[model samples]
Target: MNTSILFQNVKLGPFELKNRIVLPPLTRSRSTQPGNIPNDLMATYYGQRSGAGFMVTEGTQIEPRGQGYAWTPGIYSPEQIAGWKKVTETVHKEGGVIFAQLWHVGRVSHTTLQPGGGAPVAPSAIQAKAVKVFIETGPGQGTLADPSVPRELTTAEVKELVQLYAQAARNALEAGFDGVEIHCANGYLVNQFISAHSNKRTDEYGGSLANRLRFLREIVEAVSAVVGNDRLGVRFAPLFESTTEERVYLGLVEEDPHQTYISAIKILEEVGIAYLSLAEADWENAPDLPEMFRKAVREAFSGRILYAGKYTVEKGVRMVELGYADLIAFGRPFIANPDLPQRIANNWPLNQVDPSSMYGGTEKGYIDYPRYAG
Candidate 1:
């Protein structure tokens, strides 16, 4: 059989990947309650997908205040680190390299998801629209609520958050992760600081593009300082258009996404981080990352590049062959086929993902996926 481009081995910073396929960060909300810690089930879920060249744990909050949904895991406390140790140990035993994605939801959350039922925090005191946050409604079920009006972080508080990101990276190291990926995308905290719609301050951290990028720059610097540039990655979800109703989440598309993200990538390039993970829109018939943007990313950053968002094996191979992306992340496919990379390798049938069980559930759809036997 002629192997696809995704089957090729690649060097990603200090770690070398067995193939060009990656498991991108996904939010399953299966972490233990109260403490929001990773557990054995989560460990098994990740270990089952170890055939991928690399795996990034779901968006793990940097602090309790960082969480925006019920049951989402955190990487802040000692207990959380201990829980993640099991996950990392399992993946390592299978010879897989993994990175922990540190995240904060900013204003895209309800007060119910916040500490003391407090309002969610953001770059500005704006309420996010067209987005819903999952809150605990019962023992095993959750409900989606509209985001609450957020409190704008003062300049001092903003700086404090950067330190939190650094601390999270240190915690990830303690948890045995190979590296850390800064969740600077998806209308989250870092993205809120970058998007003009969410950040309306007149201070140094807002107004111009350079100012909007200040938070992300500071975060990358702080996290890299702890994890080293060779062990850090940044993710950015650049939405090019919002013509459809479904595309209005957090209303985050910049006036000029190409220029905005290109400049952001330039900052990452200057810092010499390990990789840049680009997340495209996942709706059906969504456009691919524009060729111009892809070229700009390749030219701006010297590190490895990863792309995600409803990617298929054929599309992944094509992107690799075109030199646009060094690795491809399959989200839904990985959910149903824990052995996704091996299945692709041997042309095995993939299990269909049950959308109902995607967010929070028991072991039924979480770790029950079968492996290919050829």
Candidate 2:
């Protein structure tokens, strides 16, 4: 047996994961259109990657207005729930633990992707600049478009969104998922509320940092009530350095990211959730998260910690060995190598990911990548 620490079994709340490798949530827009329903193809794709100790499904829209991309899946409708059941059943058959990532794009959306062509909703009326959202122009065709200006959410609507997140957690359990992870990262609905840049609300849900965090606190508490804190995880993209404009659009790259995120994490600690997934800046040549912040995170959060974004096997091993991360989520690497854990354990060569077929496509790049055959 491999003696690498990464290969050792670890406890994540009620579950004992077989290894520390995780398949992070990746948005592959292959869901069946017209309903944005998960399909058999998605099941096959996820089943192939079940060697992961933990898996999180793509950013599934929590409601109709929550979608920002073409062909992504949703968890609100009955048919969508049944469709995800197939995916969960397949992953369970392979002895893999999977979590559904509840998502709402919020202002990172085009009017075309909104319900009834309405403006996307946010904690404040703002447009996410320097970013593009995918929209289907015709069958089998799509193009990137600028995000539409979003309308501010009424205080009641914000509270209703918390209930929607809770309902999505219920749907995830009903669909046979092992747990659910809230997509609070990447300047989505939850992140927008947290960032002062986007959330310019005058209501109780905005202004002060505590007010900004109120939405996340409410959603976490509500969802935890439904799924139990042990079965819930929250993700955040905390970029401390502001090198790129896209990072500004995606994460809002808070002026004091360290303070904003550490404060957010303290709330998770209070709820005692299963795990905290932190996503670093992934763009090429992106600066590594400050060592100071990593140490702070370990000190603040008592639960298991996960880190994703452009991590290599050596880097992941180092993080785990240093006790900064309990799990390492592999995004692109997992996409090209379904048997990623085995390859890492054995030091085997990895398959290269195809950028052309990365998004919405047939099985070519989605599931056709060959496993190591030595």
Candidate 3:
């Protein structure tokens, strides 16, 4: 099969990517402790994978309360900003384009990860079920625990969160990132507000579909003011009932995912953002997105669309050829093979990812992944 389409340049917002392959945001939990700051080790990891046309950093929390997992980096502090600067600089040196993924976990967090051990905040007072959050137990030690029951965010606080997202975008730009992608997917803060099951608010920020999307619309506009719309992207994981129970834990399966997400995509389209990324179910035996839904998304949104999750070269090429996706992100494959694009180009054998060292560790499974020897 012809894989050349994956190597062709494509326009994304104001920038033109070298290829259509993307390095999607994958949480490695390797940030430096005490402040969750990015470090040189992380810089090395990204630099090694700079061959991709586009790359997004691991989900970097916009504020302290936004963290649900231990040791994930943040974009809220000056020191943290400087740390990320090193990462962006490294990628730039290799002539790679990178974007910082601004994130907030909402109620999918334990109290230990919150400010003053306070309850995690959400659109409503609901505890996330069937999910475990990673928390630091000690220096270089951590364990997964149940998410704490969350308190409802006041109307005023919801507006404040919008400004926080804008500030995070400013931070990302200051750190020399090419752009920023908002983590609005996978049961994170933004997704919590969008999911009807998680958001039971009666305020203008919830209830109706438009109201539920109000938070997202405001955030996209707010962040776009700081970083132009051409440099802003949003990610969404629209889960359906077809997903297995275990895989659906990250984001609640919506009753009408197609209608819900199409409405959300329309909002992004209205704002004229650079791109929209949709993360599909990645588990073995997981189903592909419905053809009807993909077609609907293409008709609803005019900007570039990205799809990630278990995409092989052939599948990615087909999606690009079919015009369903403008880019394909390879997550775990890029994790184990830093020269992933080259491997795909050359048909080289790939190194299997070491699952044990996937997160919060020394640079064993990270930068140590060697390129093909042949």
Local distance difference test values of all predictions, in order: 0.90, 0.93, 0.93
Q: What is the alpha-carbon lDDT for the whole of candidate 3?
A: 0.93
Instruction: In model 1, state the lDDT of residue 227.
Output: 92
Across 1-374, the per-residue lDDT of candidate 2 in tens digits comes to: 22388888999989999999999999999999889999999999999999999999999999999999999999999999999999999999999999999999999999999889999999989889778899999997999998999999999999999999999999999999999999999889999999999999999999999999999999999999999999999999887766654544374878898899899999999999999999888888888899999999999999999999899888998899888999999999999999998898888999999999988978999999999999
Q: Which portions of model 2 miss their true places by more than 4 Å?
A: 1-3, 248-251
Better of 1 and 2 by lDDT: 2
Query: What's model 1's overall lDDT?
Result: 0.90
Error of 3 at 355 (Å): 0.3
| Model 1 pairs whose backbones collide | none
lDDT of 3 by residue, 1-374 (tens): 88888999999988889999999999999999889999999999999999999999999999999999999999999999999999999999999999999999999999999999999999999999878899999998999899999999999999999999999999999999999999989888999899898999999998998999999999999999999999999999877654445435464788899999999999999999999999988888777889999999999999999999889889999999999999999999999999999999888898999999988999888889888888
